[model samples]
Target: MPCQSSEELNVLVKEAREFTKDGKVADYIPALGRANPHDLSIAIQYPDGQCISAGDIERKMSLQSISKVISLALVLMDRGPSYVFDRVGMEPTGDPFNSIAKLETSSPAKPLNPMINAGALVVTHMIKGNSIDERFQRLLSFIRELGNDATIQYSEEVAKSEFNTAYLNRSLSYFLKQHHIIQEDVEELIDLYTRQCAIEMNCLELARIGLIFAMDGVDPDSGKQIIPVHIARICKTFMVTCGMYNASGEFAIKIGIPAKSGVSGGIMGAVPGKFGIGIFGPALDEKGNSIAGIKLLELLSKNYQLSMF
Candidate 1:
């Protein structure tokens, strides 16, 4: 009842789950390597309070890059678009999410897009808080507010694991410090960024948060605007261009919807006026996206005609 067909979703999930064998789980960060490759789930929420879902809905996964969109929305709410955009450009990079090659070539060293690690670092730095804890708590609260779910919390094990292996991210932040894009201690900001990426949520919660952005920052359950309409538009635009890392163009063309994906094999999608979708499949393809997740979405988009274009 969440959308128009829960029965159909049950069938689709079964077919999509079959594709999980084609991809591999993300294992660079040791903790992430522990996830079961066979697990897959999808959650869909509509503005009218309907919930449709299938698969392993109880599975827990980190936000990964999908947190970038949340951080961007929070920064925009606190500092507005001009201030946030001034630090990060609206452009997309064809490079990998953590690549620093663009920084060296670009004179100002502004991150190519907010969805990348470099730009997400800048956006996290702009979060309004005096201390690292305050800033992280602010972000956590904002995420919970969106989904109306206060139980959501960061996976400290995952965050610390990310911290232990964040050599490239550390280097990226140092470069930002060098360019003066970030003024705070480099370690503190990277910690915040990693923690944001480590926040854990299930498919149901992911769908709720996606629903918020899908509704232009308004939570229909609460009948309140948690984020401004214009800022949501900005975030959604970035999601389309850079949410899938270098595979964004293909995803936009094939899926034709605004979506953000995380390395945990999670993708948060907004179908404009229709519905919000959250999918999880631990297996990833070469581009760091859930191979099974993308396959499921393609089927769903075709069935529901969910393409925004």
Candidate 2:
């Protein structure tokens, strides 16, 4: 049976929360380490604008890897997909987000796609801005327009922690520079990318952001086009092909929605004119996807028949 109300979704959320006991929260970033491992939330925004939310829906968390989708969308809008594609390929790497082996050996050394940290850094550098703050302001403004919420901001704690330990990303940026993949100053580009990943939002706001993609890049509530339809489609396609690190294939097979997950344990899924699902559970599986969040999405997809496949 379809989930008829928030009460039913609440049950699913509770069941999903139980799975967090076996997962581990990301600890690489000190700020992300503080997340409650069992805190699971789900918020779904339908095409008609009705929203149903469950446990811990109001709890705020960093966007983490989930920000990649938004950042890529902004880049695509600012510079067409062809320009963006020149820096980042659309294929899945089948490797961890921070892997550097490909850069050392691959012919071009370009990141496989923008959904990974390496690729995101490249895409961030491609965002036509004169300064780091200009790029970030444009990014934040674009994201806020998608979410229809003006309160979103970067968490200094998270940003500082991420910046302090961003050696892998820094190395990736330098490698991209060596390969002629990144044109801007590596430090400035990485700073912009890290700050973008540190953006904080509750599940409700995230769901609204997903809803824009669900509505084919239009903000359903205000009827404004936040992203062009073709770009939105490309974004969704990349989400399916490469969003979940090495686990994208499994997620696509099982859940069948174009979704992205962050090491901070947030997932954003777009159901193509049906609904946008936002899930947060600070514990993650090995692939860096939120464990409980993925479980909840699977159950919700089964219950609501929301899969695009």
Candidate 3:
């Protein structure tokens, strides 16, 4: 019932687009820096195959951290909750997404949750495969199926850029390696992880993926359960707790949706049992979330009473 038409959604997008000025594109990844800070787009997907969109919904962007949630779900299906949670904690962190401070201080030394970079690395490590390419291909296949798009692929430019500049990620991997949380070569893991983060798609495809999560992992078209109910619940729980990096708590208070954000200025939100939302606003706030994207979500949530809480 929310945003029943593109015209209604366009008005919201115009209003939220103003916040784009207050943000800046993420330059840390180098390739992600090329995005237009003023660009804003949104797509909403319903279980009944209805979709409403605004802005350039077809524009492709790297998954960035939003890939973390998908990867987490894949690994959970791969290794099961017992094995995965044994290596990663279930709690959220208050530090920056890429911060290494918590790893040193935490008693067990595992990343607090799968949403942060450290935990994401651990989850990526758990992906079942005999080789890097095999693992990455499997993960990609899973993602493709989730979005119902075979054309989904990674941006080599972004992948290479993140792989080269991921010095801090290397540190986290080495630390986890030392603790025996992961036994693979750090470089190899980084290669696969970077590719995982670099997976790219348009906002419409992104919304379809969110729609799967919103529907408890069932593909409405095929009626196939892509992700188990319990696993989907766990992934959604993390999205609520840590999806927006350190700003997750505030995002919850304001937007109140199960959402994940990426530094590429992408947000994937699942409004339980209703619809899925995908947003692209490359301008990022201090916490590395899309500024206009969050504003738009806030507007939609308020207007439609979409908050789960």
Compare the candidates by lDDT and give the number of the best one. 3
Model 1: runs farther than 4 Å from truth? 1-5
Error of 1 at 32 (Å): 0.6
Residues 1-309 of candidate 1 have per-residue lDDT tens digits of 333436788788778878888889889998999888888789899888988888877688899999999999988889988888788899989999989999999978899889988998888889999899999999999998886779999999999999999999999999999899989998888788889999999888899888888999889888898989999989899988899999999998888889999999999998886778898888998889998899899999888788888
By TM-score, the best candidate is: 3
- Over the stretch 1-309, how does candidate 2's per-residue lDDT look in tens digits? 122348998899889889999899999898898888989988888767688888877788889888889888888888898888877888888789889877777777888888888888888787777788988998898877777778889998888899889998989988888888887777777678889889999888888888888788988777778789999999999889998889989988888898989998899988887878888899999878899999998898898786788
Higher-TM-score candidate of 1 and 2: 1
lDDT scores in order: 0.89, 0.85, 0.93
Clash pairs detected, candidate 3? none
**Candidate with better lDDT, 2 vs 3:** 3
TM-score of each: 0.97, 0.96, 0.98
Candidate 1 weakest ten by summed lDDT: 1-10
Model 2, stretches more than 4 Å misplaced?
A: 1-5
Write down the worst ten-residue block by lDDT for model 3. Answer: 1-10
Cα lDDT over the full model 2: 0.85
